[model samples]
Target: MADLIEKILSIEGGALAITRDTAAKLVNNLVQNGEVKPEEAQPLIDELVARGEAERDALREDLAAQVTTLQNTTQSIQTMLNANIKEAPERAIHELVLLGEQITNVQDRLREAEKQVEENTRQTLGQAQKQLRIAQARLVQATEEIRTGSIDEA
Candidate 1:
């Protein structure tokens, strides 16, 4: 349980870090474009980062509860099997077979979910990278304009 919680926290932390970084970049772009005040950017960015961390903590708690429920269910199933094994061999075997089937179905669903998560993560990372590149290009352009003392010729 501890290991599972640790792993979940690590994944959630990474995701939240990426989200906070992306949000900061977007806010910086807004400041550059005069959509947001330069003085307001830091407070807004800090608020967003705090919100993301709070959300990550909430999700971690929910996942931990789910893990606990699963562990309890497994223990109950084991107890049931042990109690019935000698007195009701046939019924116990049938129950075990059904449990096996259910477990297999769950495993299949989990695999599908994992695949979807992987795909979504890939897409999100790609989009974030693209946004970062665009932000960098704009910064470079602004720097060149400053160096050359060129006003917007529009």
Candidate 2:
């Protein structure tokens, strides 16, 4: 009988298992075992049943509180997700706009670099042509002096 009581009481989360019927049955078994007499059975049964009811009520309250807390947390998370979902498009657009501006800047810099390269190439070609012309004129003057009597007199 003591062992039975201990086993029932020692169970973890036993409030869900301990009902009025189970309490009465246990008390009846204790009476049959002569641990409790027939006259004492009713009071013991009532007390055990009441204790089970109290435990059940307490468990029900705790479960209700936990359910409410879970619902509130779920609502909060849903609201946050909804807000993020709403803002996702805006964020993407903002990022794309920034990327477009950066691309345009890069294109402009590339154009400027190309223009500078072309100008430098043109200037280099012009300088080379001028130098060639000067060298050709000097060579012609030397040829004329050699062909005429100026070379013999010098």
Best by lDDT: 2
lDDT (10s digit) by residue, model 2, range 1-154: 4454556556624545666677777767878888878887776666656666787899899999999999999999999999999999999999999999999999999999999999999999999999999999978888898788476444
Query: Following a full C-alpha superposition, what root-mean-square deviation does model 2 have from the true structure?
Result: 3.5
- Write model 1 residue lDDT over 2-35, tens digit each, in one string: 3422343365454356365765786687689887
lDDT score at residue 103, model 1, on the 0-100 scale? 100
Q: Model 2 clash pairs?
A: none
Off by over 4 Å in 1: 1-18, 89-154
- The TM-score measured for candidate 2 stands at 0.77
lDDT scores in order: 0.77, 0.80
Candidate with best TM-score = 2
